[model samples]
Target: MQLRQMTDPNLILFDVEAESKEQVIKQLVSKLAKEDYLESEQPFLEAVLQREEVSPTGMERGLAIPHGKSTAVKKAAFAVARLKTPLEDWESIDPTNKVQLVFLIAIPTNEGGSTHLEVLSTLSTNLMRDGYMEGLMATNSKEEFLSRLDIEEKVKSNSDKKYDKTVVAITACATGIAHTYMAAEALEKAGHELGVNVLVEKQGANGIEDELTPSVIEKADAVIFATDIAPKQKERFAGKSYVQTRVAEPLRQAKEMIQKALSNPDGVVEENDSEEASQSSSSSNGSGGFLKDAVQAVMTGISYMIPVIVAAGLMMGIAKLGAMPFGLVNELHEAKYATHSNELFVILHHLDKFGVLIFKFMYPIFAAFVAYSLADRVGLVAGFIGGAFAGGLHHTFWGIEGIPSGFLGALILGLAAGYISRFLNQKIQLSKNFQAMKPMFLIPAISVLSTFFLNFYVIDPVFGGLNVVLRNWIESAQGTGDVVLASIIASATAFDLGGPINKAAGAIAIGLAADQVYPLTARVLAIVIPPIGLGLATVIDKYVVGRRVFEADLRVAGNTALLLGFIAISEGAIPFMLRNPLITIPINIIGAIVGASTAVLLGAVQWLPLPAFWGWPLVDNLWAYLLGLVVGASFIAFANIFIRFAMIKKRELAA
Candidate 1:
């Protein structure tokens, strides 16, 4: 939970003889591996590589923290190395962007608790000192190097003196990597140099690392998030300093950004001018550039919306089953009741009767949050209007009453609210007296009014047209009832396993889930299969190459991956990819596509999204689903064996 707790003195390598940056990384990682600081070098190396791919670890002012989450890391660890010669790496706020001091942090992928944050925060605060990094780099002895950080003071939380300065910050980027950490460090360093103790946090693929403790955060003058990724626990900085920006500006114009944040606590920054901002925004959105914000916004919305979705979805599932046992539908429905008897239905029935209303309205709540992330204050009203419109439209189309669009309507509605609110804000003017009323009254009122009318009139007709077109297309595809198209989609869906093709399939599945036509199980499986099945492939052929992954590290990754796979977690694949992407990716693709295709042909029903219900098996046909899993897993295993053999042969040739 503290920085020193994770730092091993033995892993601290100073005055090393490494010719290249890669050599430095390998030496440190190999040492960690040999010392059992990590489970193995391959996973740690892979994590480092993966992190590199996302964003370079090099920071401004000659510091870099290249960190990753891995099952290879048995315990959280800090591998500190001060380069004897300056080594080149990706950097933020660096024209050359080379690295000298490298801190490779290895954390267990499962340590999702505060441990990750603690390490990140500790490093940020300590390294923010202007002399701190130089001191470490200057030290020839390992003892002096670790001592430079004053690691002991960090361990004794009570000994630290709290400096109160309003330190504004930002965290944003395309990959959400190097710049995120660098900008935070720059700001923290600015505070430190200015005699202000600053606490900075970063948001990245690995999650929020180095979060300033609440005590530290509360005592701070203010906080700034220069990030495209949504800052975790935003409400924590409510009363104090808070601001948002694109990643680049904080690094490019560090002092200016900090000064601006200090000046305006509630002010919002659009770093449209910075190259980092433009590049990042472009990468995140692509052709549908507007959608770049959409993914993060929706993800944040969904994350917040999960508790509601789970509560409501499960309640309804229970209620439906309960109604069946009570003869609410028919005794024939009892056949489906093989999985659950009257006893289970009894619990479900109560939930349905008492909790349906709350669950039923979950979509609207979800939409509201999504809208809020986009258009801020005005989005709340517009989001609700959009959700209501979608629900009403569904009712009108099917000649049914009270059917909620759930996440689908929420998604569409949130987007609609965002656009509408943004447009309205541009058109409207705020009077001095009515300033307080902007977020509270004017923005919401106009946005809601505009979105409601548009969705009811314009959006409904569009939905009807699309729905008809889709139904017809599906029927045409299934003309002979062979489900060939569905099978093809399934195959394609699983082909690449988190690659471009895989993502495309996932998008399509998510779209179907929104439409209520595709079962929740299919979508969940699509998400789960790549990570899980790849894990399975690794487990099945742990000794495929004999020397590559046939060890304790592979076993650890395999077992952890299996657990994550059953739960439909994508993180499970990370371990295998770190060890061997060449083998793992291809194997994952085969399994994912085969399983998906078979499930499509078999028509397995997925009732809930990945969050609430995953890996239950047999909603449509448990045996059929199980069969698909076997086919998929086997395909990947065989492919991996071939790839691993080739890799071994290549290594032998080199040797």
Candidate 2:
């Protein structure tokens, strides 16, 4: 495995000329072919090009390493080039880098795993040493250059280097070939130079190498996630002080990243220390930065809330259905006053109470996660207290029960708790010994008190006042414009799919249902209709139109949309909406309006804040709800298919 045995001088070129990235690659790949190391030049060339598409192989200091793993390679070999003119057009990890030296490595598919490790351990190690690359460029002859590489000292000076601290790291890139190993080597060397033991795990093409054990992770002082994708088993480093960055950053700034991790080994990641967690994929449709982060937190809250909503809704629905056969639907709707004598009926009554109790935690879990996103674990206590008050946790005074603002209370209080805790952590000056007090004691106290005051004085009064005004207006107006109100709210819910309008629509719907001024019939119907309708259109496209209306990729996306629709995430329809905003958005809005208004006018009353089929039994008139839902969804599905097909036909005729 000596570097000298791997190649001959004929493979190394000097004073090379290239105008583009492709030209340079072609020149190098031609050498591998001429040397009979490759079975096919074109196939291997395509392999290298496909690797480049994932992420460029360029590094700082005017160096690029383009590599490929293919069966077309007869042997594992490499070619080097010292360019006369820099390849300015080459895409690089560091955008400012213009390639002056290129190393092209070819590995046979059979020996890919073993050879890649050997190539990286020997070649990448030498490249990390100071003046190693400069020495390569300075050599006048190929024989002299080969001598310089071999004659260089091989013994490690860091063998005697003692370490007191340990930093665990995970390095991964898009291809998990070049940049991944380079970053790991760079961190290990830098850690050695700094007198620290940096244990690294490489998640690469060869699979997990030097995997860190739980024992080692527990003993480590800090963590570094150098990855382009989310690192596997990230929960292992949950409480550790950490830094997260792209895979290639360590090739240049390895020491700096390590030092920051060492200094803050007992706290949440500071804003100045590293970049924020990669944006949540759910928030891709929103405005970026703070707004995106806010939406991400909300989505996280929503994700946790789903199980609670589904379980509670399903249990309640089952209880209601079971009681219908015995003429005890009213008695078993709530367990508070169950008059049933039979053991079977008694169990159903208990299930009804359990479901009602479980529903109370839905908003709390939502708020807790939202707070976790903003302020980490310290924000949970305040989130629960605020959420309980927001959902009206039954503390009565003067014959009035708890004043519940529902989602509005949870949203406001959760955000407040997160920001306040984050601010306190950053602003409060603390000695080294007192750092533990910030997350455990100080943060929870201040956050909970703030939540109590905000909920009691401000949020409660406003929502309570609105509820009184709405109750009066609803009773006086009776059925006047009931469908109009439903139409407006439902339309807004699907107006932009998962954008701001769509997100805020939930709160508005919940607000209307707080005091039963209007039932949640419209809101729940609107939630599932658009995504399910759009999803159905794609599935039945060929059947109805005698040809596939959507492309191959979109057909797959439609199946995903259909699955997500049952879980009531409107984001499933986001792709369709994005593809034809004018067509899809308006149609979605109209569909939601029709579904909501129809459900409302038909007397399908739903007082609870739940969505999807699990909530169907909770509706006062189940048949009416189903009928309205079918009518509205069918309109959207058929309308979308015919309009898009006609448009396609017109384009075909013109062609």
Candidate 2 lDDT (Cα, 0 to 1): 0.71
**Each prediction's Cα lDDT score?**
0.56, 0.71
lDDT tens readout by residue for model 1, 447-514: 78777677666665565454445445543553344345454345444443333344444555566567
**16-114: candidate 2 lDDT, tens digit per residue:** 988877788899999999999999999999999876544456765688888889999998888888999887656554545778988888999988779
The reply for model 1, stretches above 4 Å from the true place, is 1-119, 125-142, 151-182, 188-225, 229-244, 248-296, 306-344, 348-362, 388-409, 423-442, 474-655
Question: Which 10 consecutive residues of model 1 have the lowest summed lDDT?
Answer: 276-285
- Among these predictions, the greatest TM-score belongs to 1
